[model samples]
Target: MNPSHRLSTFNITTLALGLAFLYLPIVILVIYSFNASRLVTVWGGWSLRWYFEFFNDQAMLDAAWMSLRVAVTSASLATLLGTLAALALSRGADFTGRTLFSGMLYAPLVMPEVITGLSLLLLFVALGAGRGFWTVTIAHTTLTMCFVAVVVQSRLTSLDPTLEEAAMDLGCNPARAFAAVTLPLILPSIAAGWMLAFTLSLDDLVIASFTTGPGSATLPIRIYSEVRLGVKPEINAICTLVIALIAAVIIVASLAAKLSDARGESGAPL
Candidate 1:
């Protein structure tokens, strides 16, 4: 075969192997979620007992609800704040300390979670604020906002500024110009950022553990505590359900993106 063909074959092989390496554990976990055996490795028979047990467990259900609420609230707030920050950073003229401001915005993205948690805990204590759902929400928003800002900045970088200018030329006010011209173009990025923030908030354990108070346990905290005792099939089942839900969200988002692209190409309004 030609050298180019051989290289293509090698690339394909590498990609397949990489995907398998990443997904193999997920496949195992999904399969074992239905296993009847108490031991994770030994599959005595195919059964849905674990799923039933997971559904019937009130603590798990409460934790799941708490996680959902926190993720939704934090992601929404983060998206709003990050979108504004991205617009200001991307569109505003250069000013003093711009670089420092940008660095501060991204600081939490690279900072260790332990340090962030510790700092926030101390700040709360110093301010006489008690840990609870609001504290956890604030912690999650701070971390998730960095991801939102990055995603929004990337989208804004590629956008044409002429649309906003044209809208302004047509007598549209600044806010109206953004709503009519800028917002539509950058909506995909905002949506992606929101999803990233949601996922990050959902998966967070360290910060949640530090900020959450009694009766405010999130799903990750509950799962981590349970795993310390020992692994259970119910944990596997819960994970399987979460994985399935995330998969569904991704698929739906992909389809929606394709539709949006098709509409844009057809000169239809979003």
Candidate 2:
């Protein structure tokens, strides 16, 4: 074989192995979610008993509901604020402290979650604020916004500046021009950012634990507590359900994006 062909084969083999390494644990968890045996190691038989048990566990259900609420609310707020920040940062002329501002925006992305959580907790206590749903929401939004901003900024970077200029030349006001011209182009990035924020918020556990109040415990926190007591098949079932839901959302989003792309290329004006 040629050297290039050998290199291609090596790259493909590396990619497949990397994917398997990342996904093997998830595959095991999904398979064991349906296991009838309480002991995770011993797969007695295929059964849906764990799912039934998860449904019957009211506290776990309540925690899941709380987590869903927090995740949706926080992610939405984060996406909105992050989009605005991205637009400003992307469009604005270079100014004093611009570097500092950018660094601050991205700091949470690299900061240790434990440190962030503890710092927020301390700040809240210092300000006489209580730990609850709102606290968790704020913390989630702070971290999630960084991700959304990064995604949006990347999309904005790829956008043609001439689109905005053309809209302005067509007698549309600045606000109207952006609403008509720029918004459509960057919408996919905004949506992708929102989805990422949602996933991150839903998966967060360390920060939520430090910020949550008595009644504001999220699903992950509940699962962590339960696992500490004893590993339950119901936990596995809940995780599997969450994984399925996220997967479905991603697939639907992908299909919708593809459809939109096809429509855009069909000669109909966007």
Tens digits of per-residue lDDT for model 1, 1-270 = 787666677798999999999999999999999999999889889999999999899999999999999999999999999998898799875977889989999999899999999999998889989888899999999999989999999999888889889999999999999998888888888989999999999999999998999999999999999999999999999999999978887788889888888888899655
- How does model 2 score by TM-score? 0.94
Residue-wise lDDT of candidate 2 within 1-270, one digit each (tens)? 787666677798999999999999899999999999999889989999999999999999999999999999999999999998898789984867878888999999999999999999998889988889899999999989999999999999889989889999999989999998889888888889989999999999999988898888999999999999988888889999999989987998899888878877896766
**Model 1 alpha-carbon drift over 4 Å, by segment:** 1-9, 268-270
Please report the candidate that would top lDDT against the real structure: 1
Poorest lDDT segment (10 consecutive residues) of candidate 2: 1-10
Report the error of model 1 at residue 158, Å.
1.2
